[model samples]
Target chain A: MLNIKDLHVKLEEEDKVILKGVDLDVPAGAVHAIMGPNGSGKSTLSYVLSGRDGYEVTAGAATLDGADLLVLDPEERASAGLFLAFQYPVEIPGVGNMTFLRTALNAQKKARGEDEVSAGDFLKLIREKAKSLKIDADMLKRPVNVGFSGGEKKRNEILQMAMLEPKMCILDETDSGLDVDAMRLVSEGVNALRDAGRSFLVITHYQRLLDHIKPDVVHIMANGRIVKTGGPELALEVENNGYADILEEVA
Target chain B: MGLPADKSDATADRLAALTMPDGASWARIAREAASTRFQAMGLPGRRDEYWRFTQPDTLNAIQPPEAALYPPEDPPAFSALDRLSVVFRDGIFDPEASDDLALEGLEIERLSTATQADFHWAKDLYGVLETRGQDPVERPFAALNTAFATDGVVLRATKKILKPIHFRYLHEKTDSDAILHFVVRVEEGAELTLLEGGPAAARFNKCMEIDVADRGSFHHIRAQGRDHERRAVTHLFARLGEESTFKSFTLTANGRLTRNEAVIELTGDNATAHIAGAAVGDGDFHHDDTVFVTHDAVNCESRQVFKKVLKNGAVGAFQGKILVKEGAQKTDGYQISQSLLLDEDAQFLAKPELEIYADDVICSHGSTTGAIDEEALFYLRSRGVSASEAQDLLVLAFLAEAIEEIESEEIADDILTRLESWLVRHRG
Candidate 1:
């Protein structure tokens, strides 16, 4: 459902290259994970795909279901069913979490020319989703992630993913700051949203997250390129021996 | 051979040209004293310390651009509240449109109808609070308002009133110039809530003096209307007794020039006062808020929260101070003024000062002016909210801090609706 070909990106303000000749493809209904050591351009790829500013796409083409994703604004891309779960969720003070969700939902509806959900229906829907994520009413009543713990913030992101129901989901280091319990709850939430028509690109440094939400394929990235691609066992291999053998094999 | 340069005071020349209203009421002596005080002080000059950030030209002009009273479209603010309404058209009290002047345990009398034989509760209050508020600095317009204002209301609350008193000022004359003065007294253990709304005239000068006795409570909410060519200069003087509570919130939409100054004195121990303003401005809009609070009694608390949103070269200014006397121990005072500039041309100037002479007191003040948070903006936009929608959300969030100071939820909601509609109109 998502495709990229020879994507080259560099920092806009500085003469620094982040991604050099990277290419990947995630087919419909498939789950893929990208694992690499530090500074391997995994998060950079996610940000460039999400149309974040401060990045110059030197050479590349990215399309979602054959529709040009780079041409659309971030919000337009969101309406076109591209979702990126941020690694560090922003803290917005004085904006209630529920209000934010409602505004977002109605905004998307207006863009899609669909009937907006009533307040009562929205309350019920949010409550149902929040209960599954173990979020209480107080969390929804407070400002969006203002003082939320790291785990709470991650869980909130998963809750947003559940509510948006995008066709393709990109999770950037969702397991970075999570503990064992939080990781399991988050993986369970992701697993609950698994469907035959949906796809996920899980980017992480550890193999523990893949244990819960098992990926159909695993790719090893190093020096701005996906150097190795294999079945799920590649993740366990990297987890066991690290990226030493993989880098040497690619070399 | 050089010609002599003109040395006449520009400030005095501006005030001398305007004629004072004719009055021979019981406040004649107070009026004369204030007239003399104004003559000495004259109009505020551009070089004045308090008027440094904001120019005093538009406010000092003898003839304001005649603003044709725009047709009223929206319902008056606080219409849903159960209130006793008093209407004013072009600064003149309209007896027919107003409600029956009656309230339980409260006395309401018009200054025009008050008789000399039966001097209302305002006899001592005509200019007493204004005179007391004048200290190191002079407010000549407030003195001028005292000297010439002929139409207003005197309110006295003996007990807890069931409903609030609403004063709706309507503009119907293009060249209307109004000077309004209002006095209110809340007795011991009594409660009062006052609400004022409207764009009164092209050039409006208003003063409200409030005195709350021990253990009394007073809540005020004002909504300054949108009139692009209108210029207004207003003053609020309040004194709180022991254990009293006072909170005032103002919502300013838009105007050519507006300067709202507030002076509050905490006279008795354990009294609390809060003053807040939330303003929105577009092109050709200039809004200023100046507040001074004095903690004269021990264990008193005062807070000032002001927020402004300026766009398209609009200007906003704030000058606020908190002073704690030597014996006012354990005083807790907090003040914060913030502004959101939508673009590079918009300007916000703030001066926050704290003067504490007490050995043990907690007084803190802060001021900030900045654009909307980029990270927060992107966060919302990434969630499918449009760019303008995200901006509106952030603007509202920025204003929520000051809007929360309103004591009534319903009134706050009404103001929020008005702000939303205003944003929609300006987005065009």
Candidate 2:
């Protein structure tokens, strides 16, 4: 479960409030979609929740499964079963994807006092997951995101989430640049990982991704605040009518 | 400066007058002429071009006298075993510490025994590849080495031996300057690998010449001296034959003041040469690598890559030049020098040059100096890798590009392990 209470975050040394008194909660086994226009602070909410720097949490609280997510560092949050699928995946040259994934997986395992996975087991798991995603074997050998197409990078983020098997995941605009075929692949990957014990917070500007994901709850966020909550039909309305209609209802 | 001035030299002269090694005749003449050159040029002053980036005061302050060939006052940490290892203590050969190599078709012996067989292979090639028209600022030190560097190894690969030859130099607390000259010839179609490393914790100067006959290949890896108070200057001049290849990898992980000069000439068509250097400095250490690759024949390919990581107010220097002569058409040359400064006070200076007279050639050079990427660090951190660990991995990746050129997997692994250890120590 994930919960945020009156989350207020401001950029360092600036009075501009990126996340203004936002509140949301996602119970286990539920899929939540947060939709808003540009600059509505959807990405900032994810980064602030993930504990990225340059943003000050002036006031508010964020908790995952009753544990303080805001107080933990980025790595600690990752170990605590929080995963953020970045909108723009970083290109890390000379760092092989397999090596980076193994490091992260084992680091979380170590943090949890669990036994580390054997190299053979790790390789097998990644190979199986990568096969299902239609990722070439060479992609695992190359540097992380280096030379990878935009769709490939987004798919890689999903592959990582699958490999990590985190309890809570926040995907930030993962379908922004994906073609219909790539989006189907991404949605299939996300669907494959769905379970009753995990929660996913999908953030996007378009309703196309929601058509495939079919969130259990939809929250319309406007001006850094969630104005309304509705069922899956809400996304279709926003898709057809846009944010002005939602903002007028909230006002 | 007052006690027993030149007593060891006087004694050496008296001994040379009586029971000098038969092969010492040419060495004697060579030594006298080198000494004269040193006296005429004197030690390099700050005004000299080559010495402009480096100061000679540290070396000039060392009043090294000719060492008396004596057994060690204490046991050395390293020993020569079944594998052939040439030992140099204080730049003087320790006959007791060396083993006679018995590989077939290969001739490995001390320079004092300079034989006709040795000259038949490499006599005509020695001293022909010196830095052209460049003044030797430390001429005195080089002259001293030329005069007294009596017994060094003269290795000849007779039948393309693949086994690596190891040269070990060990020095002690004494103030001594060593001049060592090495001549190696890989016969036509032969192959050889040489590993030269030493803990020469004193002022030392070295000159080595190698000739790779037509179709012969040579791989040379040199790990330089390490002493906070010592200075080291080393020169390597090599010529590659037609269709032959010469590759040199130098690792400078520890040193106070160190300079390495590499000059490689591809004299025959279809020759290939590569020079790679990686150095790390965590203290006030200073490391410099200057390499020149000349393409005199057609269809020659040459590459040079240098990487340095400097911290704690250290300095790193790299100067690389690739030259393609008029007729050396179809020459493909590439050079790159990159440095990572880990500390605010660390500094790096890199210069890359390409001189091509042939219009049909491909030549390019690049140099970059920067700190570690902060965004990359954040990404690694977000992935659960600690900051220091991330830095270490990035630095290793930076240097691995050069070290990966080594043909032998074992040697590459060994160098990587050593680099990891050095990073661990510095990070601690």
Candidate 3:
């Protein structure tokens, strides 16, 4: 469902290369985990795929279901079924969480030429979805991510993902600041959205999160490229040993 | 010392175009005193400290600058509320269009009729607060309005008012120069809400004096008219008694020049006051908010919050000060003024000051001018909101703090709706 081939990106303001050459493919219904060390361009990859500014695509292409994701604006990419759960969700003061969600949902619907959801239906739907993530009425009423705990921010992201129901999801370090309980809650929320037509590319530094939401495939990314691809045991190997061993072996 | 020759000449020329209306002996005395005060101060010159940021040439002109009437397609602001509507057409009191000037727990009278009476309660306050506010800083325009204004309303609340009083001004004449004065008194333990709206005239000068007695409360919400060519200068002077509450909020959109000045004095202990405004200006729009709050009693609190959204060469200015007197211990004062410049050409000038003679008071002030938060903007757009819609949301969020100062949720919502429309119309 998602494809990237020889994606080379550099900082737009400077001539520093971030992703030299990267290639990845996550088929429909597959959960792919990308494990990488710090400064290995994992977050940069996620940002580039989501159409963030300050990044210049020097070479190659990325697509979703054969649609050129590189050419579309961020919102258009979203309407094209691309969702990126930010590593750190923005704290937007004065914008209620519920209102943000509703505006986003309606905006995507309008962009896709679909009828907008009624307010009542939206409230009901959000309540049901948010309950599964343990988000209460007060959290929904408050400003988006303002004063939210790290775990709540992550869960809010998952709630957004579930509401958007994108065809492809990219979770960039979702387990970074979460506790064990919060990690489990967030993993469960993500697992609930797994279906035949959906795909996920989970980017992380640790293997513990994979225990909650099992991945179909694992890729060890290093030096701006995915050098190794294997089964879940690859993650176990890295967890027990380390990326040092893999890097040395690959070299 | 005498005034500068040019300043005196300008003030004289402006006053030459106005003929003071005849009134009772007391009213006549008050008008003459105000005129004397105004002449001494003279029209604010460009070199004046307070007028440096905004030019007063048009405001001091003899003839009112002509402004084409912009009859709003939408219904007037606060029209949905159950209110006692008082209408004015081009500065004249339109008795036929206004409701009966009577309500329970309240006494309301037209300024024209009130001044005509030989003995009236308004005579005590018509220009009393304006004269008091002139000290330390001169407000010559307010003095002029007090001296020559022949149209407005006098309101007194004896108890909690169930409905708000709405003053709706309509601009139907291109060169109409309207001067209006309002006097409000809230008795002890009484509560009242005052609502004002409209583009009164091509050039409008307005003055309002409010006295809130001990334990009384007064809420004011005003929406300046949407005439893009209109020029206006307004003054609001208020005195708060012991344990009283005073809150005022203004929402301004689309005017060529608007200067709103408010001076509040907390005289009795434990009183609270809040003043807030949100202005949106696009192209040739210049809006200024000048506020001064003084704390003279112990344990008083005051807050000022102003936000402006300027685009397409619009200019916004804010000058606010908080003064805590020597014996006003434990005073809590906070002030914040911010502007969102949508483009490179939009300008925001702010001056925030705090003068404290009491060492124990806690006063904080801040001013900021910036473009939209790019991170927040991208965050919204990444969630599928279009660029324009996302910017509008951020603009509303930026003004939300000022809008929150409105006590009524319904009114706050109405203000939000108006802001949204303004953003949509001015979207890039």
Model 2 chain A worst lDDT window (10 residues): A46-55
lDDT of 2 by residue, A1-251 (tens): 99999999899878898888999999998899999988989999998887778899989899999999988988888889888898988888877899889988888898888999899999999999998899989999998899999999999999999999999989999998999999999999999989999999999999999989989999988888888899999999998999898899779
lDDT for residue B344 in candidate 1, whole number 0-100: 91
Task: Compute each candidate's TM-score over C-alphas.
Answer: 0.96, 0.89, 0.98
RMSD to native for every prediction? 2.6, 5.4, 1.3
Query: TM-scores of the first chain across all predictions?
Result: 0.98, 0.99, 0.99
Model 2, stretches more than 4 Å misplaced? A13-15, B1-23, B64-83, B95-100, B115-122, B131-151, B171-176, B225-230
Best by DockQ: 3
Q: Report the C-alpha lDDT of model 2 over B125-215, residue by residue, as the tens digit.
A: 4343442312322334444445455457778886778567778877665576666777788899998888877656466778777889899
Query: Across residues B8-107, which tens digit of lDDT does each residue of candidate 3 receive?
Result: 8877887888889889999999999999999999988778899888988889898878999776638779988999999998888898999998889999
Interface RMSD of each: 0.7, 1.6, 0.5
List where candidate 1 sits over 4 angstroms from the true fold.
B1-19, B22-25, B115-118
All candidates' lDDT scores? 0.89, 0.78, 0.93
Candidate number that wins on TM-score, 1 or 3 = 3
The DockQ ranking, best first, is 3, 1, 2
Each model: TM-score of chain B?
Answer: 0.95, 0.85, 0.99
